[model samples]
Target: MAVVDVALAGRSYRVRVGAGLLDVAHCEAHAFIEPYGMRSIPIVADANAKRLLGERLQASFRSAGHAIDWYEVTPGEGSKSWAELERLTDWLLTRGITRSDHVFALGGGVVGDLVGFACAILKRGCGFVQLPTTLLAQVDSSVGGKTAINASAGKNLIGAFHQPSLVLADTSCLATLPPREMRAGLAEVFKYGLLGDAEFFARVDESSEAILACDDGVLETTIAHCVGMKARIVAEDERETKDARALLNLGHTFGHALEAETGFGDRLLHGEAVALGMVLAARFSARRDLISLADAENVADALARAGLPTEISALGLDCDGAALADHMRHDKKAGGGTIPFILLRKLGEAYVARDVSLADVAAFMDEQLQAH
Candidate 1:
């Protein structure tokens, strides 16, 4: 087991990475909630996750002398809506949940994002534990303090920066994940390599099979390495004030736009959208001569090899480059007239650039769609 510390001044917490940590007699969750002096806990889980690891977590927390209440949201991207948040909060209040209580988000990115944001605004603010079940959530969303909910305007338009008290990433939970979901998660794993650590990206190239196979050792190493990378970056810049943390959004700008254009529904999972977004970012960088054409090809190849979507047209999306670019303008990262995009200089090196003209982005996207 490896423990990575997310140093955030007075609110620092540890991310414990290991296999079977969830079944180890309150190993991870206890260490996190005990410090908060919380006795009552409300667990917000997705239906699929509840069918898988929810019982074990509930049993462990109950056995640890904490009163437990559970809430299950339907599994999918649609669950991150204001209506769902309101319903869950009402459920909690009916159960007599107070600000002193904590919430345990026990699912993938959607569950973590919605539940974390719910806890953030519930009675002002409350502690929450991130027991990220999916690979995407474990390595990315679970570690970052950015919690959000989707609105009529766009995805993640309404949210807060509420940090989790602890993050428990049990590799075992990924065993039952569908192949598509596993592939979706690989996008974030690739993002870590693209954003920083060229060496890590190389390792991912070599270990893509072992990772997708859910090999315990490889999975453990990959999750801890990514967590450590994010922990260091987030500790230094919690609110993304500096560009330090924006690197984490290497493919997110384009990714979020695709999600919004697609209605933020099951048509595209967040990770899948990011997978395509990364390839587009790489291609756009190449178009600008920031990187070579080979770099763009390499990114596309890596994502395709990992079984993730590498082209927008391949997703069966009916939208065009102009429509997609229109969604980008509404992005929270958009400022003054340009959307800040994290583009790669090469694998493992990413930087935010606000100078990218929307016309060029649309043209590049059109080229990819035509090629597909």
Candidate 2:
């Protein structure tokens, strides 16, 4: 088992990563909850995760004489909405969960975001634990404090930065993840390298197949590497006030718009949209002369080789560039009416480019669409 500690002022936590960490979580939870007088825990899990390993987790807890009140939601982006939030909060309140008790998010990113946000606003802020089951959640949202629900206007427009009390990422849990989701999560792993670590990216890109094949050593190393990078960034800029944390949103500006355009449905998963958005950002960088065209193609090729989307042409959205750009206005990065996009100066370096005009983005997207 590998343990990485996120040292945040006033709120530090450990991110435990390894195979078969799920059983360990049960033991730890028993120690924490039993003496604390919290006999039952409200576990908000997604359908898929529950079907796969829910019984095992529950049985482990049950063996220790812990009661689990399981609340399940259907998987996917659609679950992150105002209606679901309201329902979950109401259910949790009915279960008598207070700030003193901890709520558990035991699924992928959607469940983490939803449960975290619910805990954030519930009773003026309750504590929650993250049990990230999918690869995307393990690598990205589970460790970050950025909890949110989708608004009608955009993706993640409404959110709060409420750090989790604990994060348990079991690589073994990823065995149950669908192929598409596994590939989508790899896009985020690619983001870590593209944004900051050239050497790491090179090694992973060279070993893409082995990593995709779920080699335990490579999988653990890849997840730990991404988590390490994120832990440092979050420590430096937990709220993204500095440019350090914002760099994490390497392709989010365009990607969120793509998600909104698709109504946050199965048409485009968050990681898939992000993979496509990274290509767009890379191309836009090339257009701005910040990076060479060959560099942009290289980024696109790496994403494609990982079985992720790298183009906007195949999405077949009926919207135009102007419409796509309009959705970006509601982005969390938009401040003072000027949107900031994370563009790369080179393969391993990224900086916030806020001066890029929306008209320009729309036009470039149109060009990309027409080309396809």
User: Which prediction has the highest lDDT against the true structure?
Assistant: 2
Residue 25 accuracy (lDDT) in model 1? 32
* Candidate 2 lowest-lDDT run of ten: 29-38
TM-score against native, each model? 0.95, 0.98
Tens digits of per-residue lDDT for model 1, 1-372:
888999988998888888887776365565545644444667888899989887787778667766656789999878988899999888877866667666788899999999888888888987888888999999999987999988776778889999998888999899979988998998899888888988888788789899989998999999999999999999888998889998898888889888888888778888999988898889888888889999889989988888888878777768778878888877876667667889877777899897888888887777777785
Model 1 residue 229 CA deviation in Å: 0.7
Query: Candidate 2 — which pairs collide?
Result: none
**Candidate 2, residue 18: CA error in Å?**
0.4
| Residue 40 local lDDT, model 2 | 76
Over 165-187, each residue of candidate 2 has an lDDT whose tens digit, in order, gives: 88888898887877898899988
